[model samples]
Target chain A: MRTLAQVVSWLALAGTLAPSLFYLAGGTTLAAVKTWMLVCTVVWFVTVPFWMDRAEKD
Target chain B: MAEAPPSSAAEPVNEYEREPVPEKARLGFKSFIGQYAGEHTAGTELMIGPLFVASGVAAFDLLAGLLVGNLLAVLSWTLLTAPIATRARLTLYFQLEKICGRKLVTLYNLANGVMFCFLAGSMVTVSATAVGVWFHFPMPGLNDFFPNSIGWVIAVLAVGVMVAIVAAYGYNIVARIANYAAPWMTIVFIAFGLVGLREFLNATQTTLNSGADLWRLCETAIWKGGTPLPGQVKFTFWHVTFFAWFCNMAMHIGMSDLSVFRYARKSWYGVATASGMFLGHYVAWVAASILYALQLLRTPGNTDVLPGPLADGAAGVAGLICVIVAGWTTANPTIYRAGLAFQAVFPRSSRYKVTLVTGLIVAVFGMFPAVAMKLLDFVALYGLILMPMGAVIFVDFFLFPKLGLTSFYAERTGGSFNVAAAIAWFATLGIATWLVQAGYTQIYFVSLPGWFIAAGLYVIVSKLHQRLAP
Candidate 1:
């Protein structure tokens, strides 16, 4: 479960970054990039907490 | 309210304040990398990056200056700070107490705590600007000193109170949140730069087929070198370099990061700071500068450097969240540290009550926008004031033995204050202040000479002090 959480978290991170690159490359609108980033942000917060702090418990 | 020893079998020890970090507790190099990357890429980067643009820095000056200055900063951490930290493995406060004595350390703590309050207050101001974006309140401009409207005042008050309350109550939770937000916030900052760059290119109809074309766009549209805006100084290459290098002088030269690095398994792990210097100071700062430049390009009249609207314009809600979270996370630890400083001074006070009061004081400081507006000068002054003590510590640690003088004089003599350390600290401050006031040197350049002055004074005064004693 933790590994799955970690993978999902990494995807969320990538999701946050991809839209900006797409917009910069002239492949997407600024509006679309902003919306995509906002969604990725939500996913990041939801999934990251499951694994990021596990070291403390270990 | 007595603090537990680090070696106590109890759960969750109080960070080994008085004793050396145990070998088992030492952290790996990766820890420092993540820690620096997060800590350095803070909300203040938003203010600082924009201020560089306000100072009318040219393209090469801003770029090359940051590159060189950040390299020097990383080296300072590796060579100057980390080596001492790994060997001593003691907190800055404890190390100073040994050398300067309790009374002098109290004075130092007072100075440190007050500076932390103002620094934290500026973070509150940064966060308040995000609130302004959402609420459409009139935020302070780059040159505005006071709260401009009732709405602005109320917004600052509301944001400050929320931050202070959380800092006083749930600091650990906020720290965790900050850690989680670091990677996301770092990406948002990159997005800000990219989006700003694209907008600038589109608005100016510039095509970047070559490196030269990109350079031309940066020179012409982004950081056009000319007269500074009203109430700002014109920056040269040296100014950018010195400002970048000395901006965190309190941590590296002033030895405040001894506490953090003391837990490192190896001193060379200081190289991990390059992640922060390059990623945050270089990338985030340049990105923030691009955003501000775009603001100027679109509306030639708007000179306000509010991070909230700026971020909102770039990446929308994500940008606003970045501004708020960045400010809140950085300010939380600052407020907590200030509280600890204050609590150390008045040992009988409850930590909760002291932190509550400290947070409220920081909130009051936040209400005035001057500190945030003129952060460049404020940061320089902060580093200048605290840097003299770093010289004293350096001299005592390295040169005292060679010079036939005892190290940690106060600790050796069982005294509450060492007059030699006091003389060195005060005299250097006085000289540095005079140089700045008399226009002999700007605040950015004063610390270099001031360090030498403090080191020399410490050696001379210690000779007389030890000779005269007994």
Candidate 2:
């Protein structure tokens, strides 16, 4: 039940944010936006292992 | 979502490489690139570009939006999907099984596999057009759902058989075909771009000019900024932007490619995806659109999007063949993935037999042209349907601890189909569907936020129900 509520809230957030990002970022700076996205991706990739806790058997 | 597999001094937890997991093998960087490029440079481009033209995206919206959107797509794969894939060492299905349980995973696998098949079938449809051009078969019309001519039917069957055979052979075969095809096919894609530029020059009867002139051409000719075809959605810069970004939402945000990237030596291997983003999605998409826009200009009556005709007009028979094979490269692995998903359903079943069966299923669906005909909506719906489980997997992997729940809780708890995951998946869908159906917003635009929604929900649900991973 808690999971369900969390999912709902996230979707709501996504709805609010994704489109807003398109607008706020000023879709006009296509190259800059691409660079920004690429940087985000690079950071995400490099650090994911550090942040994630792996699965373990009981 | 399975709790970390118990470890002793003899075995240490593998970080990014595959270790401590039986039957899981880590892959090098090149394989990851082959997989990404091969997957994204789909046969569907022939279909997608024309449809965009049909929708009448203005030149700037289509051009500028794709430039921005595709980069976002590439980033999503690099950032959101790759890191987990390199770290997890499991297929999205297997990892989810650990989190959501076998029953829930089975449902997701079915959806994932089916979506892959439909996607493959469209490629088959694209390839068949080349056969129609080469072999003199009567091609199906855009509105033609069923195989209109005996020749078209034969061509599709022949293409389908080849695709199925290759798919059944396994990943080595799939990767090899993609690798072999990528280089040559990429050249052909570039040629398509150059030819489009040449044709545009001829049409405008003007020498190449400064940026403003090109922008004007985009507004006037390329995007032409028109309403969509009879049943298609209107694509403004926003629609084009999101569509370009989310076209591969299932693979990136949905985490389906976790199966393919688990082999990477480092997550940064994902940067190679730019090869496909630029080569196939960016260059090819724009080039193909130029070709189609040219077609609409030359003969306004020809609404048919068969690549053969478009390619023939752009660069003779060679372009036609490129369109066909481009579809094959993309579709081949997609069918293979679907087969793998189906394989999970009957664990004892051989992948070869499952792929063969799944290929036949898609081919049969191909018989009705509608599957390929309405590809835009099909792809969006495809991503939407499969995405929730992907979200469940991501959250189960990354966010569970933050929620004070054990990751991979299902495997640890000995549950089949984690109840919290199962409920979260459906509940997110139900609500998202409600928003779309009630006209709150469009479906194509939903995936980005929808992904976060499902991910957050999975964790919260895991906490509320105390469902224990099982």
Please provide, for model 1 over B448-467, each residue's C-alpha lDDT reduced to its tens digit, 9 standing for 90 to 100.
89989999999999999999
Each model: TM-score of chain B?
0.97, 0.89
For model 2 the local lDDT of residue B42 reads 61
Write down the DockQ of candidate 1.
0.88
Q: What is the TM-score (0 to 1) of candidate 1?
A: 0.97
Off by over 4 Å in 2: A1-58, B1-31, B169-175, B467-470
Model 1 alpha-carbon miss at residue B73, Å: 1.0
User: On residues B186-243, what C-alpha lDDT tens digit does candidate 2 reach at each position?
Assistant: 5455555555655665677745568787677667766687666666678898887888
Tell me how far the alpha carbon of residue B341 in candidate 1 is from the true structure, in angstroms, after superposition.
Answer: 0.5
Among all windows of ten consecutive residues in candidate 1 chain B, which has the lowest summed lDDT?
A: B1-10
